[model samples]
Target: MTRPHDAAILELKNLLGPKGWSMERDVLETHNREARGKFEGHADIILFPASTDEVAKAVAICAAHAIAIVPQGGNTGRCGGAVAGQDQVLLNLKRMNRITEIDARDFTATVEAGAILKTIQDAAEEHDLLFPLSLGAEGSCQIGGNLATNAGGLNVIRYGNARDLVLGLEVVLPDGSIWNGLSKLRKDNSGYDLRDLFIGAEGTLGIITKATLKLFPHPKHIATAWVAVPSPEAALDLLALARRTTGDAIAAFELMCGFAHDMSVTHLPNLTRPLASQTDWHVLIELTSSRPTDDLQSLLTDLLGDAMEGELARDATLAQSDAQRKNLWAIREGIPEAQGFEGGSIKHDVSVPVSKVPDLLTRGMAAARDLIPGIRPCPFGHVGDGNIHFNFTQPLDMDKADYLAHWENLNRVIHDIVAGLGGSISAEHGIGQLKRDELAHYASAEKLKLLRAVKAAIDPDNRLNPGKVV
Candidate 1:
């Protein structure tokens, strides 16, 4: 006997035509996994809808047949949020890639969910504006995925996350209803903000089709610096000092553990080590402003001098040119991929209060080391937002599978400490299939109940991105 979803798949293909549907093994293979390649699942069909109406129609058909649909973007997610399972229908948004509108005067850009992050950034730059939410994956990640996860990148220290960047959204509800909420208005307090509900819902409530993103004036004067610190505490102190001096001109403050920097230099090609001595901690700082007369370098230098005088930063180097700035940034941006090349790592994207970061790292690293004796803890990420990617590499000559086998045990140890510190188990990467169980374990009963109720209300059939988030 054929399942109802099988027939639904056929109906969808017929409705969408060849250009809108694909079942080729190669194409399906490409859609099976996320950027990390950790959680790959097979999909029987991949649907490509060119517009929100088509997406609504396909979703309605799938909902009617009780078929699970996974909304996918550029597939650059660290979590397995976008991968389609063998029993699911993959709804790819690449065909809908478009910049619907760019209103420089209004300080907003309306874009399709499938638009690449870099493309939108480029568009904003063309208009002498800035789209500040950026990460290493910006070249490949999509706006929908960013909104879905509420991504926190380097500039999050200043401009904030993807959620803050979005003013309004166009979403396809679970029942296939198109909600046209794409307003560029900065202040619209009509009622409950629906955009906030779906911004970080991880596609559990609905599929985001389009969005109106906030833009800022492009910075005319920019400065980049790499600073050496004795510890996370020192780095945190230096961060406070910089903020006090520059106000909000401080654009980014990224923390890099020496282990992580060393790994990048060891693994990545042409990546020279930045600091003269291997300090326990380092911070990549960036300052920017639209004012042509803004002396970001002088401000940065003054802040660094104060930090050094206060014994917060041991040494620092400011970038003299664009190439030098890029080189300094490459060390920070390449850490994750370099760790990947090293071996299979048990990764956690966790966040604690900025004040508790040092303690969190101290206790978490100690516990992890005791568990695996020689496990290498490479904790690095957006220190400005207090989010860290606490990842562990296998011990020297230890079997990779053996170390991975202890992932659950290690996670419990680390997460228990996080909970004690009033921190989140899954921060920016989000609770997709990768952290769904963790969500259940960490979220309060009231929060869990509310999330579940929202999911039930929007996607009663649980056909949209099933087994994702709450």
Candidate 2:
């Protein structure tokens, strides 16, 4: 027996031609599952639209049939946002992977939604420019997903979030109409700024088809260091000192807990610790400059002298070679992947004021201990920007399933502290199914009302990526 959505899926396949979609069970299964190991969604048919025109046509047919669509990019999202339901059409935009234009003069690049982030970054590097949206999933995550989720990475302290990098966007709305606002101009005081609506909306209001991104001059001289800090409080002081000493040259300032580092090193025995001193806290710092004459190495050395003398840092290791620098970064980036190999981890991608991060960590860890006595805290992330991945690895003797059962309770405990500190429940990762209820629970009545109003105004039928961020 044919289902109602089956007709819409059939129409979509017909609209895009046989080569544009996949009905094979394996392909459908792969796209339906999320990266978090949580079985979230199911889609019978997947659509592969090659261009904005094809996307518009497919969307129009779906709209005619009142069928829902879940637009997927690289499917590398931490949240379950990209997964589509069994009754919905999965629109994978990988075929739209094109760096349509690179304007060296304007310092902008126009790219299709499916373009891989690393591909764009490399293309920008070839032109002696930098994209600066560095993240672990850059190699696999697509530009559209980054934009849709407003992805924040290592360079956010200097470059800013994914939304900050976008100059303009071209989006396909719920009614199957195209909004081509892809302006390359840096300044456009035009009405209601529609580009932002789709960039971080998780494709609920519209599907991002293309984007024009801002670029910066490539850094020439680089300085990297791994320092042991007394505590999170001292780490903040070190960050302040680095910013004051180096000004705008600070590219990345990260805070890592010792357990996270040990997990990574233990998971991959070949990877060594960046620092010899075994402090509970570590800060990975990097400074970069476009000019070769900047002498960031000397600047960093002098800063480390003051940090150590002033007691902000206990000990430090500076990267003397490019290979050493990459190795340092490899350790930092490998933490999340390493956690996967350990056991069940209750993850929280959250943020507070930079000033309150120390308090958040102190109180949050204490609270987790009170709730689950033997739980291990693997907290780490951008101390410069206030976002911390306050993750908890299960107790050594606990069963994986039993530990995971505390996911919701732990979220409540941590989110309660976050709410007390006036912090966000979901920072970089959007409110996919995992946190949809949490959003409603934490958001102010006025804010929730406004959000629903906007959704109703743009997507009245609840067709575009339904049940996502409203």
How accurate locally, in lDDT, is each candidate?
0.89, 0.90
How do the residues 419-467 of candidate 2 rate in per-residue lDDT, one tens digit apiece?
9999998889888777889999999999999999999999999988888
Count of backbone collisions within predicted model 2: 0
TM-score per candidate, in order? Answer: 0.98, 0.98
> TM-score of predicted model 1?
0.98
lDDT per residue, candidate 1, 1-470, as tens digits?
A: 12436678788987888899988989888888677878996787889999999999999998888778899988888779988776788898988889988898999999999999999999999999999989988998889989999998888888988899999999999889999999988899899999999998888788999999999999999999999999999998888888888977889999989889888889888876666877888899999999998899999999999988999988889998998898889999999888977777999999999899999999999999888998989999988888998988988778888889998999999999999999999878888888889889988999999999988988888888888887
Task: Determine which window of 10 residues in candidate 1 has minimal summed lDDT.
Answer: 1-10
The model with the greatest lDDT is 2
Cα error, candidate 2, residue 386 (Å): 0.2
